[model samples]
Target: MTESSALPGLPRRLLADPEMISACASRDFARIFQLAKRRGGFHSSRIARTCELTPSRVGEVISGKRKITNMTVIERIADGLRIPGHLLGLASRDWERAEIPTQPQPNAAMRRLAELQNAHTTVPSRELDDILAIAAGSKVTPTVLRSLQVSIEDYWRRDDEHGGEALRPAVIGQLRYVTGILQDTADPNYRRSLHGIAAELARLTGWTYFDARQYSTARTYFTESLRLAREIDDRTFIADVLACLSLQATYQDRAKDAVTLARAAQDSARLDGGTPRLMAMLSIREAFGHASAHNREATHSAINEAVHHFEHVNPEDHDPTWVQYFDRTKLTVDTGTALGQLGDAAAAEPLIAEALQAEPTTNIRARAFHTFWLARTQLQCSKVELACATATEALDLATIVESPRVLTHLREFRQLLGSHRTIPAAVELVARISETAN
Candidate 1:
């Protein structure tokens, strides 16, 4: 049976579907094609024909071999499939205005949600624009919940590899939609799961903004994350959000607030019977907070505690999904980063090198960040030549990665190099960096 109507495009039922809606939100057309086939009675040939794509290209997308990114191509897909332009983060299509009267009128929430999703938008880019839009979801279902969960994971993975600057639109857009549905939803069997979904989305939206160094907007989302977590009484994720806030505080140079937030997170984790990796991640954050305060003794103590907790982590422990990044590699690099802040280059260098060696090539952002830290540690030990060389590599990566925060770190490091500015190696690195500004 056709889920759509007489038009040669997709049906209204598919557009309203949680699974398809999630796919469209992220522009995962392979999933979209698959869903259309499975749920909307549309085949690859049909999608290809309507979207102005080749059958072979459609096949590659379905098999995960390609992604569609051109704005024009995306618009064609939106129009050909009769999808609303707002859903794809595009301006309204001519066809949308021509949509027949039999087609349901889209409300303000849908239109405004589309407005905020535009990366070039004049909109304020807030997380929630219309409360009624959030309340406009269909009855919650397991399938709907599962589809959103996967998208969230994908967003984090992408952020890890390339940073979050480009992901803001999709992340924030889905968050607004999901959070609205969550508040208005009262499902007895799936209510808590929905809250978990909303909490994580809010946390991720906050994180993308954090990665961009927009602290004010980031705090609003993090605050929302905490509230949603509290609704579900999920202490693990609650602690996670607190740790994130603590890290943000460290960045903002609020050492006292940083330490206080870290400790509060730790206390909450303990009450939840924390996992080893969770405790390890929090401990390092605590260590960083102390280093910011210039408390040498407390810094080392927390470092020791972090290492101790990490040693106890086992694959079977079933750590919360959020702490999956806290593997030995992460623990090692983070420990090195915290120690570097304390100016203990001798203790920090080898650990950081090990982390860089094991770091996956796909995560360019992490490599760039850790490479810069390595240079700083080298500088701390007074290895001016080696530090300059390593810093040059960091500059290369920083140029390509989409993080302003990494560039900011590079600026701070340049100030630290003022005394060495006259050195030959330092001079060349400085000139190279200066060229980027030009």
Candidate 2:
């Protein structure tokens, strides 16, 4: 049930797949485990320690005793192995569904019809009409027809990803068609749909770069997305882009830039009578700025305001699918971290507990931040045993995601732990943190 012998160097996509496939398509557990182990840079001892698994258990997986059937387990393995989860088929998302039919081959006439249908509308409807007219008399070859269909599909795919290349001019040219349609259309519903597509496409371009940690490219994409959002008069999306810009600023430690962007977002939302959600988001940005400056009073005030706004904001009020993700619990989690940084563990503990209890499924990065703060709070309170455990958990998650922000927080945690070197457990955890740092 293994293709490892037949295909020694299969692409990473195939190496990472966990789903059941057609006959003759299967994975070699032993080969995959070895590959993961080699890529992860871990010996047996290190692997066992990080995964909290027994040495025997790790050996069994490597020897193919245990099948890699569990998604969580596979993710854990990838993390421990230091392999990019996406490259290893441990991606947290599914690929886009293809539009073309997936089945047995069609007959010659059916294939011809498909090719004609795939022809770009930008080629001129009249030109297509003329081609169809000519095709009505002459027979087309299946080879030529299939090639045309593939070219058409490729154009659309490229358009979806990067607005298409010059060879795919018809696809990019559709942007003009969209704009023209918007101008002539009077139906609000159609305009809304068109604007929504533009926003999604624009955001996807930015997300590709942002997720890859290419900040400069992401900034440009976000700026372009914001411009399109303005053209469509979508205030929510406009605010979202502003929030993203502020996020970039925060990541770069430009607190003043973040504050300026957040204030601009607040002004725009105010014109529309600032909803609870928008106000909470703006306040969150302000909190970030205050926290960066270590201004306890200002940070607390902004965080408290955010919590107040979040409590009243109905998740149903937002039309943007992403906006509904915000909640009071998450805002409080952030507030707790800010409070802890400002040396208010007494004020921070309760909020951290509430956030932990909420069991939020969204925003792992934010949760990681909260966990880092909780660890700091425990350390400051002389609870070395508990602090070390919390710090380890935060470090593990941060390591899995390769987040610089989380690593920075870990550095801070290490500094705190280093000051209290008497506890053996704390010292061991600090060693682990140091190993990861190197």
For TM-score, the strongest prediction is 1
lDDT tens per residue, model 1, 134-253: 445457778878877888888888788667876677777677777667667777557788889889999998998998999999999999999999987888899999999999998999
The best candidate by lDDT is: 1
Global CA lDDT computed for model 1? 0.83
Candidate 1, TM-score vs. the true structure? 0.77
lDDT of 2: 0.60
lDDT of 2 at 182: 48
**Candidate 2: residue 15 Cα off by (Å):** 17
The parts of candidate 2 lying over 4 Å away from their true place are 1-194, 200-213, 315-319, 361-363
Residues 109-130, candidate 2: write the lDDT tens digits.
7766667667733333442223
